[model samples]
Target: MEEAHSSRYSIHPGSTKMYRDLREVYWWNSIKKGIDEFVAKCPNCQQVKVKHQRLGGMTQNIELPKWKWEMINMDFITEFPRS
Candidate 1:
């Protein structure tokens, strides 16, 4: 369990992926629950996991230019080495 959870075998995978990995070579009742508990308590996993609900930062709106080409921004639509 330690090996799968934090040793070289692990990359701090989420509980679901950990469950799947364990399922391939091991089996026991409450295995999923155990993995969930382990992952929830894992400091490294908590730190590395993405926070889906947290906003990154405050957003500011861009002021529109009153005249055309006043704030011109261009992009190359064609592929590189254009003919």
Candidate 2:
């Protein structure tokens, strides 16, 4: 478990991923709970844990354009085949 959690290849995967990877070759009662507890206790994991929260609130309304070309839209696409 320690090697799988801290090895260079593993790199401290979150409990879900760790559980998935471990279950491929190992299984036991309460394994998911164990992995969750392990990750929760890991200082490294705690340090870099991502916070799950709403990214952006309600979108603000944009002012209506009062003149031609006031609001311009463009799209750029690369790797187009030439005719």
In order of listing, the candidates' clash counts read: 0, 0
Q: In model 2, how large is the Cα lDDT of residue 35?
A: 91
Predicted model with the maximum lDDT: 2
Model 1 TM-score is 0.57
- Positional deviation of 47 in candidate 2, in angstroms? 0.7
Global lDDT for candidate 2?
0.89
- Model 2, range 24-58, lDDT digits (tens) per residue? 99999999999999889999888776564345678
Off by over 4 Å in 2: 52-83
| lDDT digits (tens) for residues 25-82 of candidate 1 | 9999999999999889988888776783476799889899999988978887766694
Candidate 1 off by > 4 Å: 52-83
| Whole-model alpha-carbon lDDT for candidate 1 | 0.84
